[model samples]
Target: MICKVAILLVVASVVLASPYNPYYQQQPYAFKYGVQDSYSGQNFGRKEISDGNVVKGTYSVDLPDGRQQTVDYQADKYSGFQAKVSYTGQYH
Candidate 1:
């Protein structure tokens, strides 16, 4: 009987400590950055934010062909990352 009681208690604790538990949560964050140097022709930046369950961001880079490449992305716990890539400026 003691063995049965112990097993039941363990099972109850496991269920209580699952993802549904109030303490089982992730923190949210956000950030942005950039870089530009005319001397070296280096230019790139990124901005991102996460609300624990999903993440969203945008990043851009200076391309060698005189165009800028930008990417907007989103990702969720289950759906994986999705992005839209675009370019701007004249091509040489």
Candidate 2:
């Protein structure tokens, strides 16, 4: 009986923690990401939103010269892709 109870608990935990489990659901239109490594001293982050036809997003990356560049973009079936990029911080 004790062994059976342990097995049941393990199964229950696995089901609850599974990414594909029906009880666990993720937002269809929401995402977040970040990256950092030796190539750049600072980290970069991006956020995005999208449906079937339209996509909009923004990203910020730190440059090697101590500046930060931020870009905002949008793309859709009608207008295509467009982006606006800006920079900030001190550069040697």
Candidate 3:
């Protein structure tokens, strides 16, 4: 099981080289992070926000027979990314 999520952006690249550049402005960010471990049984968490157009996030994990998996996500560079999944305990 490999789960890693990273979103970091920093670019100017000579004023973005004119794909309708118009002086290159798009920057907004918010962040949250979490982790929990009960002696090698790891838990997970995430939170996010952005205003470079639109972004939202939620993440969770704690599943290994006893369920606890959740994800809620949103994106808007004209509707490019989306996710919605959910689960909760007691499913042997």
Candidate 4:
């Protein structure tokens, strides 16, 4: 009887200590790439896609004064790199 009780306690403890949580869902792979510094209020990120001679990517930065900037760029053996940036208001 004591042995059975000890085994039951061990099993219960193992079940309760599991790392899996049902409430949290994993994010998609594309959203996972980025370096963010919450303490400094800054973030930087880039992602790329390529085919043959052409390569394209997106870059983003978060400023310390509550503004964000993003750029979409592309480059090729023939056309060089070109980007367009979008930002909100002036820097404070």
Candidate 5:
């Protein structure tokens, strides 16, 4: 009986906490280097911000073939010079 009750409580808690879980919903924020609302030139870089903190940034690399390589990032203080990329699929 007690075991079943505990299991039920655990399941309830898990369901309730799922929404707040980082895996599901992340807080909306800007980049660290400060991204412009729009980019005009070929080469561009920008920052990411989350909860008023500089989270990460994105930079555009001008390739010799005229194709631009865009990079996105997420914060990782423990990993030296390491960050996660957050790419946007559509502009609209």
Candidate 6:
């Protein structure tokens, strides 16, 4: 009886686990390609599209408190990526 209850509890825990959502934890100023057939957010630019791939562009995001952060994605992967964060004091 104890073993059966434990098995049922394990099954119920697995069923109540969080659903898998890829976009739920994505970076605010980061862009990735090839996840889907086309880009899904404003993080990418049309001009950056070249030869069926992303070449160069700037990705910007506004924080909850009106702060802006921008990052530039170059090449294919995360290589040569630069991020710029703006605050009332200065840009970093």
Candidate whose lDDT is highest: 1
lDDT of each: 0.95, 0.86, 0.81, 0.77, 0.56, 0.48
Q: Which should have the higher lDDT, number 1 or number 5?
A: 1
Per-residue lDDT tens digits for candidate 5, residues 1-92, read 99999999999999987745555445566534433343554454655566533356666644445455566665543443554434333333
Provide the lDDT at 17 for model 3.
52
In order of appearance, the predictions have TM-scores of: 0.73, 0.60, 0.41, 0.55, 0.33, 0.29
Lowest lDDT 10-mer window, candidate 1?
17-26
Model 6 score (lDDT): 0.48
Model 4 regions lying over 4 Å from their true place: 1-32, 89-91
Off by over 4 Å in 5: 1-42, 50-54, 78-92
- Candidate 1: segments with Cα more than 4 A from true spot: 1-24
- What TM-score does structure 1 among the candidates reach? 0.73
Model 6 regions lying over 4 Å from their true place? 1-47, 51-54, 76-92
lDDT of 2 at 28: 43
The residue pairs in collision within model 2 are none
lDDT of 1: 0.95
Whole-model lDDT, model 2: 0.86
Give the per-residue lDDT digits (tens) of candidate 1, residues 1-92. 99999999999999977766576787899999999999999999999999999999999999999999999999987899999999999999
State how far residue 87 of model 1 sits from its true place (Å). Answer: 0.3
For all predictions, the C-alpha RMSD in Å is 4.5, 10.7, 17.3, 14.3, 12.6, 12.5
